[model samples]
Target: MISGVVVKHFLYCPAIVRITELGFEERVTDSMMEGEEVDKETVGNFLFGVLKAKELIRKPVYKYKDLVGSPDFVLGFSYYYSPLDVKYTNQVHMDHKAQVLFYAFIMEKLGFNVKQAILYYIPVKKLVKINYTNYEREYVERILRNIVKAKKGFLKVRQPVRKCANCGYFQFCKPKRVGNFYEREF
Candidate 1:
């Protein structure tokens, strides 16, 4: 358990990102290689769009609360606030209710007004604006309270997730291996 003093407060951790992203990309490549048909969900294209937008604007980018403790993208604008987070999801807009609210909270805590939050859809080249309303603000604060409790093991895992062979951890978890994949780890 990490103490409050050592808790990583910033968003973008380069070391963690390198390790995790590489592992995920390796898995994706292995499954997608040799023209194997797999229903994979990815948000690379949406991230690209964010990058394109950033390139157009001359501002610093950072991932805060990272292991290194910095914003994901810190930009230098006339306004003091320079924190922005890019999230990609399959759903159009409202599905990302909890996460966007959390990001807004992080910004507020760091003394940023957080004027805008962008939710980009992968399948559709569409962007959605997340406004921090009073309702969402209160709701997210309640959720954050519950989340802190859960992190301390005061919460129980929700059950009844649909069983599927496609999830990567199925082999280790001993889920049904439809195509002999259950027997072989390779």
Candidate 2:
């Protein structure tokens, strides 16, 4: 099964998916540790009070066929459930949206009415709501197909130079340094 976290990482860099499939464990970075700390500190008091949700399930693992997702929180309301994810970053990115959309897709497949997804930015205390529509559904499906291809060793890395410096798998990737710039060597 493809995990939602892996889905998010695939969007960040397809090479990560292939590397993971090769059994190279990712080195946990300080930023990831900080994000976990932030989630632990802020999730309970801030999320519940702000969302005013009737029911809140923290880190509920949901599975549907070949996909599995454990979103930070699942909020239950009168008619539908919304997946909530907490990020330590101030800005929202496409990868983050993809992760939330993956969760929403899995929830829907399990017969839950999921109308929207929520992202909580810890640094800026920002909450962004994304409507789950056909566009998002198709987008997630396309990403899943790409992820499957990547797992089968058909991935081509096209990651940004800036991202490589901060990635945990940088050493394993072994990008060549050329005249003060790093170029990925396939």
Candidate 3:
């Protein structure tokens, strides 16, 4: 099964997905640990005090076919549900959007009405809403297809030095430092 996490990582850098598939363990950095801690501490404030969601589910695992996701929180409304994810960084990225959308996709498949997905940027106290549109759905599906291809050994592993510096699989990828940047040692 393709996990939502794998999808997020694949979107960031396909090499992360491929390295893990090859049985390499990721080295968790301090920032990653800090992110988890921040997620645990700030989720309550966001769910109850800010959004005022009717119901809040914490870390409920949802599975549909080959996709699985355990979002930080799932807010239940009168008519629909919203998957809320807490991000440590203030800036938003495509991978972050993909993670939230992946959760919404799984929720919809499991028969929950998901109208939107939410991202809580912890540092800046920002809440970004992503509407569950057909375009986003198709985008998630495309990401899933790419994940399948990556698992089947069809991935081009290239990433910028700045991103690789904090990646867990940095050691395994072993990008050679060239001048002022890093390049894969093909």
Local distance difference test, per candidate?
A: 0.38, 0.84, 0.83
List model 3 lDDT by residue over 1-186, tens digit each.
888789888888877777778888765799978768766666655565667678888888998887789988899888999998888887999999999999999999999999999988877878799999899999999999888777767555556678779887888878777665666532
Candidates' TM-scores? 0.45, 0.88, 0.86
The candidate scoring highest on TM-score is: 2
**Candidate 1 residue-wise lDDT at 102:** 56
Off by over 4 Å in 2: 29-38, 177-186
Q: Write the per-residue lDDT of candidate 2 for residues 29-78, one digit (tens) a residue.
A: 89978769656556755777777888888889998888999988898888
lDDT of 1 by residue, 1-186 (tens): 211111221011112212222233114465444332121113323343554443222122223353112222332334433233334345553325444445555556656665555554444555555666677668755754543443343222211234224334433334334443332111
lDDT of 2 at 25: 73
Clashing pairs in 3: none
Least accurate 10 contiguous residues by lDDT in model 3? 177-186
Compared with the true structure, the alpha-carbon lDDT of candidate 2 equals 0.84
Where does model 1 exceed 4 Å of error? 1-89, 93-95, 163-186
